[model samples]
Target: MTLSSSAERPSRCADAGKLEVSFEFFPPKSPESEVALWTSISRLLPLCPSFVSVTYGAGGTTRERTHQTVARLVRETDVPPAAHLTCVSATREEIDDVARAYWAEGVRHIVALRGDPPAGIGTHYEPHPGGYAYAADLVAGLKKVADFEISVAAYPEGHPENGSVDTDIEVLKRKVDAGATRAITQFFFDNDIYERYVERVRRAGINVPVVPGIAPVHSFKAIAGFAEKAGASVPSWLAQRFEGLENDAATRQLVAAAVAAEQVLDLVDRGVTDFHFYTMNRADLVYAACHMLGLRPKTDEAA
Candidate 1:
């Protein structure tokens, strides 16, 4: 699928109205980061996302912290919390216990993942012995414990470990068959990649929503590093746009906003109605993008 030139792009969706946007946040490490994260949450809560998700770190390093954050969201906020569960370094009983605990705490949404290897992204992933083999297995286990709404990860380019696109789609199908309600994609910068990926998934008879995950590039260097490991392509044009702007923080942020807004508007023009943002615990850039898409804070009257 070829992309249109920026000037040749169609008009924005006037009648599209506000999209159903959700955010994914990670568990913060320090007290300061914790405060910052909640502050970001408070800011985005008014946007009334369908739900907010907390990420489980590699090897389940942040399991307790992820639980703490999800539990707090359930206890304190009006938003629904989706806890990320992974099948790395955790036994079946332990993983099931976590799911049961989330159920007891009123969290009904789970993002099941075949987590990165304990050694990290580039390393080979050997599923823990006696543990769930992949996200599909974990999703199946969660369904038995409770009627939970499960979301699993989907890769547009392809999973890092998968042999091909057909294999990736088959893995996704397996997850859905195991009862996942939806599949959220890993972040990709190019809109065409996402559009074509969605088309392919639909053609494969997977009817569930494959929500595009949009990551607002906060730091060019940091995001580039992540993009390398996640199989998300970083276009040379994007690199050129950010070239030599490292010394200019304010200008870099403004450029980031414009780039992300264009990416989303392009998507909306292509008929996307749902979005999942990787907020990285920051609010302003995403807030601006959502505003451009016509999303607004819910007022008391509306509530």
Candidate 2:
């Protein structure tokens, strides 16, 4: 039985077991994008994600936008919000003040990262003279500011700059030791790479949840470009699936839903329960994928 990319998802089973999911969104750059972000949130909210996270840009305008979106989540939504924080150009005092302000706003979770250099990815990363230096240092510093639940970045394929997976695991161990509560991976298309990475992580005695990040292919061209820079390999079959559909947006949406659902369902089969979706601030495909996984809009029994 061949499954069409857009075929209806398999029916949910009574004994399908339990699954949990979280979503990640970036700060919108414009009023139109902001509207799109909230619309996405409104759609996913009914599915009751474990917690939603907003991505932080290294500095300047994006940083402030991240704060505003996160603050609004705290004030307007019932779901817990996790704000991304990175150690890059800022001093320790500046980073600490941001953490403190989040605490003041009742935001309790952070995704701490040793961000790319101020020049962006592919450039040499230099720690600021007065900054926390790396992700581990930032994690420790945030812990000092408050007992915030922190998540750190992980890589299925070793990080582009790291020479080996062993070194990557070492960096993760340091972050975990410094009080990271969990690790969310850089998105990858291959589940086997993720499984092997998790095996290596557990072997190193790191026990916190290493959530798999799922990136739906909103645009093959865009995702392919980003994945290339991030060191994740885009499989040949995946490329073939999207090939020649460049001019067809409707077909692309169906293919995207099918691809994401297939990945998540396979993950559930592997006994993994928690998933982190890189929503890219759109809801339709992600929503359909969640529905395929048997998740439904949560109802308030009191209503």
lDDT tens digits by residue: candidate 1, 1-303: 997675554435444344689999999999999999999999999999999999999999999999999999998998999999999998999999999999999999999999987654558888899999999999999999999999999999998666366788989999999999999999999888888888889899999999999999899999999998887889999999899999999999999999889888888888788999999999999998888787889888997
Worst 10 residues of 2 by lDDT: 6-15
lDDT of each: 0.91, 0.89
Error of 1 at 9 (Å): 8.0
In candidate 2 the C-alpha lDDT for residue 146 amounts to 95
User: Can you write out model 2's per-residue Cα lDDT over 1-303, one digit (the tens) per residue?
Assistant: 975653232333422337788999999999999999999999998888989999887543378999999999999999999999998879999999999999999999999998876544448788889998889999999999999999999988888997477888999999999999999998998999999999999999999999999999999999999898888889999999998899999999899889998898888767688889999999988898888788888778822
Alpha-carbon deviation at 288 in model 2, angstroms: 1.1
Question: Residue 238, candidate 2: how far off, in angstroms?
Answer: 0.3
lDDT leader? 1
Error of 1 at 101 (Å): 0.4
